[model samples]
Target: MPKVKRALAVEDLTKIAMYSDPQIAPNEDTYAFVSATVNDDNEYQSQLFLQKINGGEPKQWTFTNAKNSHPRFSPDGKKLVFQSTRSGLSQLWIVPTNGGEAQQLTFFKNGAVNPEWSKDGKYLVFTASLKENDDVGNQHEQTKEERQKEKEQQAKEPIVIDRLKHKSDAHGFHDDKRAQLVLYDVEKATFTQLTVNDTDHGFEDISPDGNLILFSANLDDDADYALTNDLFMLNLATKDVTKLTDGNGSYGNARFSPSGDKIACFGHEYAYSGATLNELYVFDVATKERTCLSSKVDMQLGDVMVGDSRMGYSTEGPVWSLAEDKLFFIGSDHGTTGLYQADLKGNIEVLYKDNNHVFGFSYNGVDNTFILGISTPTNPCNFYQWKNTELTQLTNANAELLEEVSLSEPETITITAEDGSEIQGWLLHPYDFKEDKKYPFVLEIHGGPHAMYGQTFFHELQLLAAKGYVVLYTNPRGSHGYGQEFVNACRENYGNGDYTDLMSAVDYALENYDFIDNDRLGVTGGSYGGFMTNWIVGHTNRFKAAVTQRSICNWLSFYGVSDIGYFFTEWELGKNLLDDPAKLWDFSPLKYAENVETPLLIVHGEQDLRCPIEQGEQLFITLKHLKKEVAFVRFPGANHELSRSGNPEMRIARLNHICGWFEKYL
Candidate 1:
């Protein structure tokens, strides 16, 4: 008899090295990428690796074991510049490819990040946060001890809030700090502030002529109220700026064309608010006329395949093709992320497509070669070079570890919702499958409400499947990848539309799959998914067990607590908490907590600013007060990203807590 391979365990996933940020060298043959893994400190350790396209073992470039990323190769290929926090703060560092120690390039009060090398390679444009009253020119002169004294004094003072957007999930409390566009001249070793908006200025592509820089900013007085940004071009020589966008829509991810005759950007008119499908647009440099190049393509023009990498979003340019006649970019279909190319005539074609997630990619238009970061259900993530049709694997970060572990593959399924709309989802069978035997089932949901779940390696789901439970997850309405109308259908009607879609998926699975035990069922999710789980338990008792993590219980409270609460409430709910308290109360899961019958588990991260621990606390307390079977588990110092990029031990413990609860109940 053949022996079965060991099923995937949480321990095995914690050991896999997650890869991101693929950078192609100017030489066109070599590229660099970042590989991160959980270290003994229970924190993610990052390092950059260099590899050749032809064929060679990946060579470790930086050994800082710190946060080293955003690698950019100089035009001469003699130097590699990247950002690292080895200096106690995030600072730009550069090193010679041949051999040399990295040298720190900036000493600002707030460190720099996301440095972009210019076409001439003489200047680097980066983003850095600055206090409202801080002086950029004199910040480097202030000593750390002096800064600490000032901070200590400021801590004693009360935080006087004035701005509408005074906090965010990424930038805690805002602190009146604004991220601005700054330019660094490598030759002069000087930093110059370009824009003075109190808000952040996103640094985009630098013009080919090296005379102007493109950026996006909402400089209006009521910028926080309106969720739209306009493109601006700063002339380096004259220190003048030009507004390119009309501010009618939220425009970003701006990239200049090769000839400088056009600009390609991404955005929508907020036609459907949060559910608006990302559209690709082109602006004529001379005519200043904007056109939606992706109007004909029914798909969303962004990479929405959810994964466990913290490399930032992969919504790259509508990058211009080498010939300047076409543009290349990434887009999502049913459940796959594909690299696509579009022409000036609004025609888009898939250059590469498969049942996998392309988290990022770097292409050398001149050489017609590409380095892509891809992952499948069984694969973590690795860099591959697309030379013609063959994609050569350059980095096997998880190959050996995965060889001994068994992973489940998802079977794609489609079900019709109550509204006659088609919903897409995937079903994963237990590792040791027996078609005639009954098995417990778990229904998993994804957050974002805008993020798409697809054929990717999700450690949590695989671990559940390994424990003899069939898993079902789907991309319901308000999720990207589907057409515009489908995603918009969930607006202002969250639980009703999306909830039914999820229920329909479960119904379809229970009726079609013979092995699934209908009586032994469970449900769980995080963020928006967590909110859904809370809503599901309150609305129905179909499942025997449920776990809601970092969920939303009360929209009225959420409107004031969550980092993006104020505006996110208005954008998603279509009304502010004060305008219609009853409306938000009607949609809140806490309002329906009295109807809950299934045993529930509330999990949350203490440091989660996005959803806040209060969300979980409120639900848990309310359920306990009502004498319901509920439990609350909290992770110290963990954030909303606990399941994905949190501490190694905490992630494992969270998974164990979930599996243990389901095991006990189901």
Candidate 2:
């Protein structure tokens, strides 16, 4: 028998994101999207490409050597505005929609993002951060008298700095400063500051009439609290500010109706334990009464807006209809994210259903047409459009690159747990399947414990399948897409019940899929999945090898180390370390490390603020002390998102280490 070419070595995994932001032209006739391609130096460089909906060769738009993203079309559809770091810093740039030399719009030392055109198309609004008075550059230029006062203050005491990660999870690490809103006049080439404060104000939406700007911020309050984000409206003419939403909950991404009579926004009601579930809410500007539009949906709504003068909703990003009457959005329940359309009366209809993920929808108000971006477990993101109930593929972003690689299609399976609870999972067979032959298998777990592994594209899973392993992944208890009760099932139970569900999934794969080799089974996961990987190795030794990425080995240390440590531990474990140290340690994977005999590969990002590197360090140290087989691989300059959205090179390297470890041991 011919040996399966060691499924492309880990080093050969593409080191570039297959797709980026996909934006539809205002007219909806064509679309422009950014694609990151790996260059000769292995650096993933981003470039913009344009394609028509009916089908045609995608035309390359930008030829710069820098990264470009968040492409938006002007109201007239003649100009394209986007954010780029071509000038050493991220700034706004404008070019003709038909392609031309781009012009720089903002020249501030600080960067700008989220550029939106005014209704009249004469101005643009964006967000930026300016330096404060105490900054080194500002202090260096102070007058001699002012410098002497500063010197005297410095002599009084030593300066003490206290901070965890210098950057944030939302915007990565950078200089300490505050973000503010600014507007630029397109015709005059002038800029005007719209907001002035020390607090951060983001999630901006300008009214269709351009009379009021809506946003969310926690000014003069506890900025660190997640529940403090409230919607605020700024009158552009009088510079008057009004608080639209109040109370201890988050209200953001406010969008005004075409007539400016109603506002659509996403609200998150924070529970006592700090777990937030996003729901859609609409406020009648005249009555000042808020109505819950998506309370029955039981999932977060994103990208909400007034489309075609009708209320439309999306989760995290908006998908307005071409005629502006229908709004399309992605809603997830039971781990499946699908596209749906809703009207002003809160009536919703499913537009498309698939086991994959769908997002980034653009509507052409003129033609009543729309384009959407979709991807599946075995497919990378590609542009698709719905016409006459038929989905048409527009751009094959990674077809050529992935053509040489063989990918496996996941088989959906349902399994019964020890307690008779039914769970859902996917089994991806080896690329070359043979009857009566059993192949090694790997059980993969998703993080979030709250997050789910859906029919979405997972690069790591594909690599394992290519290496002759039947990969099994599941949406166990506590995973989203199931109802709220099912999602919160693992709260306080943690490693016990969830572990049983995963082990049950493994059993189902072995029994049902005759091709799965029971003795060569291995397991892996990250974040919460990482925690389970550790927990699994401790409780059982059925697998020959295991890989844990960004895992939590000690709940005690996690209570203080993570950014959301205090609240997360309290919510998941039912108590903080301070409240019940013994309880926190009782569920910790480190406590059961003595039973771990499976060869383990531990991976972590050096800069992860969620699980942090210490979590991996503790596990590796414990396993080494116990004389158990283990190896540690750390990715430099990567955060918790290293596996998902980290640098492409680093992501490939991380995947390679996992494949290498499994190949050697399993």
Candidate 3:
């Protein structure tokens, strides 16, 4: 028998950062990635780190004291280009891959991001904001006059108004301006504007020959309507643009084949559950015919990397290795995310299998080696290089810090649903478990309804399990990593089948785990999970307490309030609000507010445009008016990502409220 650990303190969170998004060098001899580390002040700072494959120490490359990320090697692998905000704005910075003084490349008043070097290493393509009134001579005179006028205006009016969206926890918002493509010539040391106009173009890929550029844009479409994003090709020589893929669906991440004869991309037809099913398609440049590479393969395309001889793609959408016509990817079809290799003929084979989520993978054709970024429930992100079929650690981002903490590994469990479908879940018992004693259990749900909770290190889950609560979470129907059919099970059936799957998970925990107290049950989740929490409290009073974070209680209001509301609701709910308002109200948890008896705590961020605070406010107001036990907690200056990448102070406060609310009610 053992006792649960206490909640994580603010000081403990400063030990290490939960890092993802790994990119390897072209030579495969070294790799660079963004490593986030919490400072003594509890501020999370992301810096670039480089590690060699020869078992040397991992060295921190950048020391700008600001958030630096997205480190990628140049074509020659001599220089590393990245995006940083050390100059008070996020701009492109280039430093030698071996470590040297970094040089700032761009100095626009706006900012630059996503720097990709040309194959010849002569030009750099990036995205930046170019204003309509941007002119060297005219802007210089206008700035001088504006500075004098601003001083005079400030003297007359003491109130200086800020026009921007103020008080953002992350990168603050800006005006609704379009971002254009810009080409920087490394030899000429000059900047050339490639694309301009009111149309916004995003750079995705540059052809290996440097003759064509691939991008996604919303040109010739409704400015307000949420139309499909299309992929287009821009010829560098003539500046001629041609639409490659056109339809009523969004297309992005277009890559050129090694021979530059074909293009591979992944996108969905419409912006709904159908959009979630991303399929990989290839287009022959000369023939102008489209071929679906992942048509027969029922998996969501993650990322596709084309090589000189072959192309590789990930089904779960991380990273893949395509060399010599062999397609090596990471697949999650086996109930867990694992690496797999397949050929162009759709012949698939498992390369590596693990319970944890693989973030990124890279393969070197010259050395015949593969490098991967691996993480699990007990380990943070670390680099693992495969040589001669042996995997070795290349970088230890938080190995020392993790050794100081007592972390519990999650036990994988399978539960039978009402329809007899097996549901997968992971349970974390109290640090010290006593079979004879009853312990409180918290059922945590993940958002995306499309996102799966894998064997990864989750700070919030760890803190909850440490507080003497048996934490049980599962991927109900509509969660990814399973087949497309399983993910779409809750498409229009919101609270029907998915609800049964979640409840069955709780039932299994109670039936099998003897220490879980049935009377002291609690539930909490964000986004779609929040919707489930709201629906669960309304339908049954089995749980003593509940906390819903960034949730939607009413579908009808969410249609108009959310940023993607109009199209997302139409796709998932199967109709717009006008089509059937009754159906929207029927699935709304707030509609059954009168039946809610469990004491609930509603937490939301003020600036969340996804699930706006209005959703939480409506639930709070309705429950308060009904004389039910409920509390509302609003986090100011926070958005929908508050729980994951929000401000350190605010993220800790959010977890504290969840713990406090459950402790008080349960």
Alpha-carbon deviation at 198 in model 2, angstroms = 2.3
| Cα TM-score per model | 0.96, 0.90, 0.90
Per-residue accuracy of model 1 over 393-512 as CA lDDT, tens digit each:
887777787778888989999999998989999999999798899999999999988889998888888899999999999999888888887777777887999999999999999999
- Clash count (model 3, backbone only): 4
- Please report, as a residue range, the 10-residue window in candidate 2 with the lowest summed lDDT: 304-313
User: lDDT score, residue 602, model 1?
Assistant: 95
Q: What's the C-alpha lDDT at position 627 in model 3?
A: 100
The per-prediction CA RMSD against the true structure, in angstroms, equals: 2.0, 5.8, 5.4
* Candidate number that wins on lDDT, 2 or 3: 3
Question: Candidate 1: what lDDT?
Answer: 0.85
Off by over 4 Å in 3: 1-11, 133-176, 271-275, 303-324
- Model 1 earns a TM-score of 0.96
Count clashing residue pairs in model 2. Answer: 16
* TM-score of candidate 2 to 2 decimals: 0.90
lDDT of each: 0.85, 0.74, 0.75
**Highest-lDDT candidate:** 1
Please give the distance, in angstroms, between residue 203's alpha carbon in candidate 1 and its true position after superposition. 0.4
